[model samples]
Target: MDDKKIVRAWIAYDWANSAFATTIMAAVMPIYFISVAGGTDGSWSFTQTAAAIVVALLSPLLGAIADHSGKKVLFLRVFTVIGAAASVGLAFVGPGDMWLASIIVVIGMVGFGAGNTFYDALLNDITSPEQREKVSSLGYAMGYLGGGLLLAVNLGMILGWESLGLPDKTAASQISFVSVGIWWFVFSLPLFKKIKDPQSTNKSRIGEHLKIGVQRLGETFSRLKKYPELLKFMVAYWFFFDGINTIIVMAASYGTTIGIEETDLITALLITQFIGFPATMLFGKLADRLGSKKMLYSSLVTYLIIVLLGYFMTSSLHFYLLACLVGLVQGGSQATSRAIFSKLIPPGKTAEFNGFLSFTSRFFSFGGPLVFGLVKLISDSSRIALLAVAFFFLMGILLLTFVNLAKGEKEAVQP
Candidate 1:
């Protein structure tokens, strides 16, 4: 396939899978787990941590195998189905089924995250370095629009469950989970049909793939010193992205803790999603003109400001304003980070390197929520817990300054 068509098909996967991100991970399921599943305080956070652990453990090994075996798309397909099936399974979770819900969530989270390790590796295959920023941003922008639209419809269904002949809000929420699975699966068809896997370089026998994968992973770790810029960028990403992911997973529950209504919380997030679509597209253009590193710095500084604002927020209005601020930066920050990492990785080692990036980022991803929970536990204040997140962004900003992008790109092209 041509680059333009391949890029579109690739971008479509973002649109396909983001329903799980918005409704399951970010918007609906977290709240559903708390209110309907009778989950304990911090239970949803713990579930996220559990899922992150599984993804971290699997990512590099899987990436290495995919690199040797030329099976990135196959792995992506398998994980997508696992995620979609798990989403469908969530329909069975009801009141006091927190453990059941947690189990399904962990499976689904692994599927979503592990799938992305390969999906992200495909970026290098679909687009040239010059187009990476624009294409990556467009993918995120499409994700926001797709995920947001589904969330809006699902929210309406949830609030109007009785009018729609559903027994209750719980039934509507259950149906929404199934909808995410169906939506995720149906929309994923384009990419599955259109995008072919990149060729394998090693072409080792199938039986040796596992041993080779392990060896490849060890070699990459041993050679980390050869790619100092990539290492620095990954460390910077590990911290900031952890903070970003924690806020996304925790924001709804935090709003509820602060006395904001569930409806308002969902509505505020919907606003964030729509605003993110346009803002992310704009950020892509800006990054091209102003440089990805500079745009990243700008977004991190804004997140630091947002974290401080979140500390003082006392009303739904404050939550809405803060959500808007998050929308303005979240997608842009992530898209640029992905673009930066794509440039830093060696050409043939894309999947292996992307997997290592995923390993560190998701492994330490536990830190943000763990810290959030601990601070809240110690001080009995969600505000203080929110304040603690600023430390990650601060460290991210400091670490990011040391990344010389031109030098990193030069190093990546070396044999």
Candidate 2:
């Protein structure tokens, strides 16, 4: 395949499906979670945290299975369909039916999270050894652009529901969830059409997939001793990503808690999506020139600054500024991390390794939301809750120093 064409299609995957993240998950859902759940109380945050844990626990196991089975594209499609259906179903949940809405959000989020197992696995298939950074960044850039684009349309749908025949605020809000299905399904069709699934060598039975997935997972973990650098990288990615994930999952929630209106949160998140677009492009080129480690360090420094600033942000403007700062580094840091890991994963185990990797990410993700909720419970301060994330980042950065990026690169290219 021509590099340009594949890369374009790869990036399009980001563009097409990212609206699910920008509008449904990041922007609108926090408000919906609050409004539909009846309150923004500590209890609601706790429930959100609980959902995170459930997904976290299951996500890696699923990823491991996908990797061993080489079902990246297939799994991505399955989860996308599930998530899309649930999202549309949310449109039917009346505001008075808050409990039903929460259940639906959890189902949709889990499906979304589960599908990512395969999405991340596709990294190796789409990009060559030499182009992972650039390719990864392109994906993120597309996501930012795609996410922002959908949010704009979603915003219109949200604000002009009267003309659209929505009966009330709850109905209008429900439409946002419905848009997630429409947008995700419509955009996702392209990838299913264009991208090829990595062919699995594992021709085992369904029972065998489960058995081998479990067996190989243990083998991979045991390989940590022989491959300490890869293990270290996994640990590093997990810790820093935990902090990063916390910010992503909680940014809007914290903003709303701090008196920023729903619209302001939407605008701020839009900044994250669009700003993230070019930043990813820039980071990709820079990583190609400077090495992934150096580029990643720069990203962490930016994240540290953003989180530190969050400690003192007082108003919606402060939230806006924080969102911009986050947007600048968010996609770059994350996409680069994926690229770096792709360079280290054991070859032929793209799905399995990526699955294990994603599992760790999901597990840590569970912690962040749950911990943020706990912090909010104890302190009632959004800033205080967010500050704790910095600690996770610090731990990751420290572990990163022990991992040899060059060795990972060499190993990743092995047949």
Per-candidate TM-score against the hidden true structure: 0.95, 0.90
lDDT of 2 by residue, 156-253 (tens): 87788788887766677777778778888887876787787656566788788788778877887777566567888988888888888888767766
Q: Which stretches of candidate 1 lie over 4 Å from their true place?
A: 199-206
The lowest-lDDT stretch of 10 consecutive residues in candidate 2 is: 39-48
Q: Root-mean-square deviation of each candidate, in angstroms?
A: 1.9, 2.7
lDDT by residue (1-415, candidate 1, tens digit) is 2378778989988898999999998888987998999996578868977998999989999999998888999999999999999999999999999999999999999999999999999999889898899999999999999999999999999989988999999999999999999999998888899898855566577669989999999999988889999989988999899989888867877888999997788889899999999999999999999999999999999999999999999999999999999999999999999999999998778889989989988778778888998999999999999999999999999999999999999999988
Least lDDT summed over 10 consecutive residues: which range in candidate 1? Answer: 198-207
The parts of candidate 2 lying over 4 Å away from their true place are 1-3, 37-47, 163-165, 198-203, 366-385, 412-415
Local distance difference test, per candidate? 0.92, 0.78
